[model samples]
Each structure stands twice: as C-alpha cells, then as structure tokens.
Target: MIFYGKQNVNKVDIEAVVSVLQSDFLTQGPAIEKFEQYVAKYCGAKYAVAVTNATSALHIACLAAGLKKGDILWTTPITFTASANCGRYCGADIDFVDIDKKTYNISVEELEEKLINTDVKPKVVVPVHFTGQSCDMEKMYRLAKQYNFKIIEDASHAIGGEYKGHKVGCCEFSDMVVFSFHPVKIVTTGEGGMVLTNNKDLYDKLILYRSHGITRNQDLMTKKSDGPWYYQQIDLGFNYRMTDIQAALGYSQMQRIDEFVTKRRYLVNRYNDLLKDLPLILPYQIDEANSSWHLYVVKIDFNKVNKAKVDIFKEMKNKGVCLNLHYIPVHTQPYYQSLGFKQGDFPNSEAYYKEVFTLPLYYDLSYEEQDYIVQCLKEVLE
Candidate 1:
C-alpha cells in the first residue's frame, strides 16, 4: 500500500553511512560539524545544533529560551503533541490558540485576541509551520515584540520551505527555528533534528543543554578549574547529541534537498489538477509563502460523499491508496483534556480534525502512484 509519506533513499545515502563506518570517528567528529555547517549555511542561520530528534531539539530550544515553571507557553491546537509537549517538558504552562481554517495554522487574529485578554501572558509563542506552510510571521513577530514574548518556530515540517523570500530556518523573524530530519522529512538523518538560531546567546544555551551542560571553553569554565583538559557542568542539560553516522547521512541527503522539495511539489500539483473538482477541499497554500508540501491533506465533504469517512478511507486503503490523517486536535486528546482543555475550546481545530485526511505525499511517490490514488479517491467518493 502507498503510505501517506515515505523516505527517498538511494545509493548515495547508504554509501555515506558506509564511509562514516569506515572512518575513525563514528560518534563525535568532523562529520557532525560538517553537516551542521551545511544546514546552517543552507537555511541562512548563524548556527545549527544537531540533536538526536526534533523532540529533543525542541526541549533544548525551549529550555534555552528561559521557559520554566510559572511561565506560560502558547501554540496551535491542531498539531503533533510535540509542539506543545516541548513547552511542558520545561514545566511551562501550555495553552492553545485556535487554527485558521484556510491554512490550518495558528490564527494570528485569534492569537492577538487571546493575548489581549490573557491574565498571565505567555513567555514564548511556538507557532507551528503545519504542512510546510508558514504561520503569519510578520504579524506574529510584531505581537511578540509588543507582548515581550519569545517566538519558537515549530518548523519541523518546513526545512526547505520559504516565507516572504526568506528560508524557513533563517530565524530572521523569530527567536529560533527547529527542524526534524526524520525519515519522512525532506532531508533524512534516519532520526535526527536541528535547532537554528541567529542569537549567539541562545545558540550557546542550546549547545550547552544539548550535551550535558558541559563546557571546556576557558571563558565559561570555573575560575579555579584545574587543567586544560578540565570541564565543568554549567547548568542542567541532556544527552541529545547526534552521531557522526547520522550526520553523514544528513550531509548526503542535503545534496538532494531541492530535488526532494521540487518532486513533492510536482506530485502535489498533479494531485490538485486531477482531484480539485472532486468531493473534497484540497490543501490551501498561502500565496505569500513557498510551501514544502510535506502533506497533501484534504477535507472530505461528508454530506456529498456517498459513504462514511471511515468507509471511504478503508476503501482507499484496500485500493492501495494508503491515506492517513495529518493530525488530531491536541487539545481534544485525553492528556490535554486532563490539562483542562475541553472539546470546543478551539472550534476550527476540532472541525479540522473531523474531516481531514492525508494523501500520499513524498518525493519517491511517482506520477503513476499519484494517478492511481486520485482515481481510487474519485471511485470511493463517488
């Protein structure tokens, strides 16, 4: 069956890993820094700290931003729990802002309204770049400056995407941008993530926490520290380092970054062309941003469709069109409900969760597979 997303790996990817295995440095070495530099330069960020996964990267990034108990963090309700869980990992009180129906991203207008009436203002606003389309960064940044809150862009789905001509990870309009290089993402490091930032202070903090808060820098070492080889634990931290093997894989994948994004866009265009008039509402990419098209989600019109959404999904699956759901409203989950978030707290997110389904979207999904999926969708809906 055609899965919703799949990784595009070739000889180059495997060869890169083999080369790393043949080398002396397998964990901490030149390859890691090489991959980091490649990503930093590509995204126009001053620094990129590689971690084991995006969740770890998010954790370190939030901690570096000074999030802690009593501090509030806000994010969109319609996203992977990792977006909000990162805040909770730092003991920050998590809150949700509803999503806009069109882009399925955090609504800037709703965010502004919430801020106007909020009692304890958020210390950080983590706007998720859902489906590789950016949130309203201009409006969000202006509000962040006014409200004295930091911005952590949850760009896990948008490494190669762009907003207003700037690359998503540039961090020009936010405190930092986080990326996930999972198997399904545009670039793959098997299971890895990176945190990009322009601020040296935040960069230093991220680096600090990423590797057990240990520092060998003489400037940061204890005043009476022993020898040149001595190190000190400056603060609380974690073991979130990415290995040289993963970095080598990431570095190789970086070469095809543009190719991967271009192929996904082509596939999305094909799907749109074939199914735009069908019994569904296709994803809407913002005109101001160049979306990476990480997901091709469509909302089924239950009233017009012949069968129940579940039956339609099952039929598609049987036909080898492995459709999936992009998300469930995080606030509606059992854990979030226990946190006091009820069913109707975010109307748009709840509505989105009810009807949306993800179609096959990835670089390796060929034109033939897309055609088959579209034909199967048409058959199922009819």
Candidate 2:
C-alpha cells in the first residue's frame, strides 16, 4: 500500500552510516560536528545544535529563549503536539493562534488581532511552517518587535523551502528556527533534529541544554579546571544529543535535499492537475514562499461529497491508497481541554481538523503510484 510519507534512502546514506559504525565513536564524534556545520551553512544560520528529535530541539530552543513558569507561549493549534509541548516542557502557559484557511500556516492577521487585544503578551510565539510552507514570518517578525516577544519558528516541515528568497532556517526574521529529521521529513537522520540561531548566546545555551547542561568549556565554568576532564552542570538540561550514526546519515541525506524537494514539487503539480475537478479544496502556496511539499493535504468539501471524512479515508485506504490525517486540533485534545481550552476556542482549527487528510507524498513516490492514488481518491469521492 502507498503510504502518506516514507524515507528515501540510497546506497550513499547506507554507506555513510556503515562508515560511522566502523569508527571508534558511535554517539559523539566528528560526524556530529560535520553534520551540524553542513546544516548551518546550508540554512545560512550562524550556528546549529543537533539533538535527538524535533521535540528535544524545541525543548532546548525554548529553554534557550528564556521561557519559564508564568510566561505565556503562543503557537498554532493545527500542528503536531511537539510545537506546543515544547513550551509546556518549559512550564510556560501554552496558547493557540488560529491558522489561515488557505496555507494552513499560522495566520498573521489573527496573530496581530490577538496581540493587540491581549493584556499579557506572549514571551515566545512559535509560528509553525505547516506542510512545508513557511508562515508570513516578516509580518510576524514586525509584530514580535512591536510587542517585545521572541519568535521561534517551528520549521519542522520546512527545510529546503524558501520564504521571500531566503532559506526558511536562515533566521532572517525569527530568533530561532527548529527542524525535524524524522523519516517522513525532507531529510532523514533516523530520528534527529536541529535548532538554528543567529544569536551567539542562544546558540551556546542550546548546546548546553541539549547535553544535560554540562559545559567542558573553560570560558563558561565558574572556576579553573584541575584536570582536562573537568566539567560543570551549568543548569538543568536533558540528554538530547544526536548519535554519530544518525549524524552521518543526516549529512549524507542533506546532499539530496534539493532533489527530494524538487521531486515532491513535481508530484504536487501533477496531483493538482489530476485532482482539480474533484469535490475538494486543494492545498495553496503563498506567493512569496516556495513550499517543499512535505505533505499534499486536501480538504473534502463535505457539502459536495456525500461521505464523511472518515468514510472517505477508509475507502481510500481499503483501495490501497494509505492516506493519513495531518493532525487533530491541539486545543481540543483532552490535555488542552483540561487547560481550559474547549471546542469553540478556535473555530478555524476545528473546521480544518474535520475536513483535512494527507495524500501520498514522499520523495520516492512514483508517477504510476500517484496516478493510482488519484484514481482511488476519485473512486472514493465518487
């Protein structure tokens, strides 16, 4: 069955990992630094810190941004829980900003309205780059400057994409940008993540927090070391370091990032051509942003289609097109509900959650497979 997403690994990726296995170190080694440097250089960021996964990357980035108890963190509710959970991990009160109905990224207009009316401004606003499309970050950046808030771009779905000619992780508009290297993402690190930043102090904090807050650097230590092995736990942190094996694979995968994004864009174009006449709302790309097309999500117009979203999903799956839902509204989750968020808090997110489903989208998906999936979708909708 065709899946919604899958990893594209070739002989080179395998060879990279195998060579790392033959080396002396498996966890912390030269590959890690090489991978970090490659990503930082590619994304045009001054520094990058590699971690175990995007969740850990978000955690460390939030901590580095000075998020703490009693501080409020805001993000779109239409993303994976990690985008919001990172703020919660720092003991910050998490809140949701609605998403744009078109791009499905965070809505800059709603964000402005929220910022203008609210008494207590958010300490950090995480604008998620949903489905590989960058948010209106320039506008968000303007708001951030006016309100004295930090911007943490949740760019988990956007690595090879660009916004207004700048690479998504360039940190041109945000204080920090987070990337995911999960199998389904643009590149695979076998479950790894990276945080990119332009600020030296935040970069240092991110590095410290990713590895149990321990610092071996003499410049950061309180006293001179008696031995070469001396270190200090500067603050509370977690074990979120990426393994060398993962880094080697990631470094190799980075070589094909452009190729992967190009293929996905080709598929998205084909899907748009084939599925335009169907009773569904196709994904939209903003004029200033180029999407990586990490997901090709379509919303079934329930009024036109005679089936519920679940029924259509089951039908497609049974027909060998294994589609998936991108997310449920984070605010409607039981955990968020307990936090005083309820069904009607964000109407747009709730509406989106009911109608949207991700189609087969990945680097290795072929034209024949895509045609089959489209045929199945047509049959399901019919």
Candidate 3:
C-alpha cells in the first residue's frame, strides 16, 4: 500500500538511536543541546529549544508571548487543532481568519479587515504553513507592527521551506517559529519539536516554560536565592522537555534535510506533470517562496463527475492506497463549536476540505510506486 506520508529510516538512523540507548544520559543530556544547536544553526536562528512535540512547542510559544484569558489569538481555521488549542492552553480566546483559496494560507486581507473592525484586540497571530507553503510573512509582519500583535508561526510542516530566500525560523518576519520532528515530517526524531527565536527574553521564557517553570536563574528569583542550589517556580509551566534519545535521532536526521526536501520537490514536479491533464485542480505555488512539499494535495472535480470525495476516498483505501485528508476545518470541531463557531464562517476552508485529498508523496516513495499511484488514480477518476 502506498502511504500519504512516511519516514525514511536507514542503518545510520538505527545506529544513532542504539548509541543513545547505550549512553549515560537518556533525558536531559548533552545530546539534546547538540540537537538544538544543529536545528538553530540550520535555520540561522539565535536559539532553539527542544520540546516533547510540536504541540508543546506551540504552547510554550503562546505562553511566552503573554497570551492570557480574555486575550484574542487568531489563526487560519484550516490547520490541526494544536494550532489553535495552544492559545487555549494559555487561557486565551482563539479565533480564525479565513484562508486564501490559492495559497491555502491565512489571507492577509481578511486578517487586516478583522483586526480593523473587531472589538476584541488580538494579542497574537499564529499563521500555519499548510502543506509546507509559507504564508505571506512580510505582510503579516507589517500587520503585526501596526496592530501590536505578536506572531507564533506554526511551521510544523515547513521546517525546510524558505521565505524570501531565507530560512523560515529566522524570525525575520515573526516573533517566533515552531517546527515538528514527527516521523512524517521532512526529518524524524521519532517525536520531537523545536522553538526558534532571536529575542533573548522570549528564548529564556521558552526554556522555562518547557520544564515546569523551575529555573535556576539567579537573577530571576524574588530574593537573593542560595548558591549552587537555587531554583524557583516563577510561573506555571509543563513537563515538555525532549529526551536525549530523541535528540540524537534528530541530530542524525538533520544531516539529510536538504536531500529530503530536494527529493520531495522532484516527486511533486512529477505529480504536477502526470496529473495536469486530469479533472483536478493542482496546488498553486506561494509566490517567490520555496516549499518543502510536505503533502501533495489536489482538489478533485466533484462538480465535473458524479462521484463525491467520499466515494473516491473509499476506492483509494480499498485499492490499498493510504491517501489521507490533510485536515478538517478546526473551527468545525465539536470542541470549537462550543466556543460559538458555526459552519459557513470560513467558506474557502470548507471548500478545500470537501474536495482536497493528499496523494502518496514521501521521501521514500519510489518512482515505480508513484507511476502505479497515478495509474490507479486515473482508472478511478476516468
């Protein structure tokens, strides 16, 4: 069966994990720092803090940005719930701006319109880079400066993507950026995440937030805390620290990120050519930006054919092709519905959800397998 996403593990990756298992420090160790340094250097960011997963990274980012109860946090509805749930973790009110039909990212025009007219001032904006395509960061940065809102880029699908010819996590256009290291990402650490930022204060806060807020910082204590054995819980935090074993795998995976991204791009080009003549709409490129091609999503022509998305989905599954949907609109979730969100609020997101399906596109997917997938899709569609 062809999977929509997968990890490319090698003997070297296995050996890296084995070495970590035989090492002295398993949790908080030098390997974790090494992994953080590797990602930070790759992204050209000043600091990178490793966490248990991308959700935890997002949570810390929101907390460090001072999101609190009654504060508004805005993002695109077409993303994983973690994108908006992180704000709710900090007790902040969460809302969403509709997405652009072409880019599948938040619309800057809609964002500006909401900010200009809404009674509730937003404390932060978390723009998700869906399918590894970056949002319009320069425009978002300008809006941030004007509206006095912070930015936490949920770059879970975009660690290797470039914005304006620079790494996405350099924070050139946002306050902070978060990355995922799940097995299906560009690189794998089993399960891990990182937070990148240039501001030292936010960096320090991220460190504290990842580990129960218990800090040994001498300067942060209320009183002159004791020597060599001083620590305090300044604010509430979580046990979100990443393990050294996971970090070791991440460090090894970092070496091949460029190669992985290159291969994904090649495969996407192949798909674009093979499926161009089909009754489907292909994903449009984000202008002037380089994507990592995390998922190859195409919109089926439900209007052209009598077959709805569900029929095609069931046929693909029955044929042993594990094609998957990227996501449903986060605002439509039952949990979010209690927050007063209703259908028809974000038409573009709903439309994307109805027709979009991710094809089998991963680093390890072979050329022959792809041809078979295309052939099968043609048989099903035609």
CA RMSD of all predictions: 0.9, 0.7, 1.0
TM-scores of all models? 0.98, 0.99, 0.98
Candidate 1 off by > 4 Å: none
Please report, in order, the local distance difference test score of every candidate based on alpha carbons.
Answer: 0.91, 0.93, 0.91
lDDT tens readout by residue for model 2, 1-382: 8988999999999999999999999998899999999999999999999999999999999999999999999999999999999999999999999999898888999999999999999999999999999998999999999999999999999999999998999999999999999999989998999999999999999989998999999999999998987999989989999999999999999999999999999999999999999998999889999998889899988888888887887888788888899889899889989999999999999889989999989988989999898888888888
- Ranking by TM-score, best first? 2, 1, 3
Candidate 1, residue 60: how far the Cα is off, in Å = 0.4
The alpha-carbon lDDT assigned to residue 112 of candidate 1 equals: 97
Candidate number with greatest TM-score: 2
By lDDT, rank the candidates, best first.
2, 3, 1
Candidate 1 local distance difference test against the native: 0.91
Among all windows of 10 consecutive residues in model 3, the one with the lowest summed lDDT is 301-310
Regions of candidate 2 where Cα sits further than 4 Å from its true position: none
| 2 against 3, candidate with superior lDDT | 2
lDDT tens per residue, model 1, 1-382: 8898878889999999999999999998999999999999999999999999999999999999999999999999888999999999999899999999999999999999999998789999999999999988999999999999999999999989999998999998999999999998889899999999999999999989999999887777767669877899989899999999999999999999999898888888888899988989888888779998888889988788767778988888888777888798899899989989898888999899889899889888888888888888878888
